[model samples]
Target: MLSDKERDQVRQTIEQQIAEAEKEMVVLKELTAAVAPDNSIGRISRMDAINNKSVNDAAYRNTRTRLKRLQNVLEKVDDKDYGLCMRCGKPIAFGRILILPEKRVCVSCSK
Candidate 1:
């Protein structure tokens, strides 16, 4: 179980990560828009742009997923089971939570 102070720290870190991911989402949206197909561009250049856009789109999706998970965790941060490993019911290390705020299982159960 985590002390109140520790939980507060985790909440603050998760909020900061959410803010950064939101900012990145905005930048990715702009990049995706800029890469839209243009007839004036050569076929090869257009193909490259399409590929870049695909990668950016995937990244944008991942960021959105991560943001959602973080927000959900933030809402549950004060719950009694918030820091417990979902699979093992053990207290997840604070360090691990700091590194992976969205983690729901411990390293042992992850195997």
Candidate 2:
């Protein structure tokens, strides 16, 4: 079990990570809904529109995945299981937590 000081430190880390993740997700949303391609001529072909749509979709999907992972990590923190390895039930190393404050599983469990 972590001491009170350790738990407080983890909580601060969780809050910082959550804020950064939210901003990242917002930027993704903007990119997905970006205005028509900024160029000399407005798009002419339906195919062009489709292609742009696909690109937007891909960006959105990738961003969603990242945001979801961050959200899951935040949830784990709330459970007081933030640093615990999901598979082995061991506390994940502090170094890993510093690298990925929202990571759910330890390196071994991740593999």
Candidate 3:
């Protein structure tokens, strides 16, 4: 269980992370845009650009997933079991929750 103050702190941290993730998603969206086939770039350069776009597309998807998880966590912040690990039913460390509010399990269970 977490104290009121601790829960509040976790909520704020999660909110900050959400904002940062949203910003990163926007940047990644631009980076993942389709490479134009009609461009004058050499074959090798075009292939490299396509590869980079694929990487960025993966990153964008990951960021979007994280954003959704954070939003769900935000909604559960006031729940009595908010800080409890879903796997072990133990209270997750305050620092761990603050750093990764989207996680529903503790470090040990995550292994």
Which candidate number maximizes lDDT?
A: 3
lDDT of 1 by residue, 13-103 (tens): 9999999999999999887886656789989999999899999999999999999999999999999998899999999989999878899
Q: Write the per-residue lDDT of candidate 3 for residues 9-108, one digit (tens) a residue.
A: 9989999999999999989999988898956898999999999998999999999999999998899999999999999999998888988899999999
What C-alpha root-mean-square deviation, in Å, does candidate 2 show against the real structure? 4.0
For model 1, the local distance difference test gives 0.92
Clash count in backbone of candidate 3 = 0
lDDT of each: 0.92, 0.70, 0.93
TM-score of 2: 0.64
Order the candidates by lDDT, highest first — what do you get? 3, 1, 2
The residue pairs found clashing in candidate 2 are: none
Q: RMSD of each candidate?
A: 1.4, 4.0, 0.9
TM-score: model 3 vs. ground truth = 0.96
| Segments of candidate 1 deviating more than 4 angstroms | none
TM-score ranking, high to low: 3, 1, 2
Ranking 2 against 3 by TM-score, winner = 3
User: TM-scores, in order shown?
Assistant: 0.92, 0.64, 0.96
Model 1 alpha-carbon miss at residue 52, Å: 0.5
Candidate 3 yields a Cα-based lDDT of 0.93
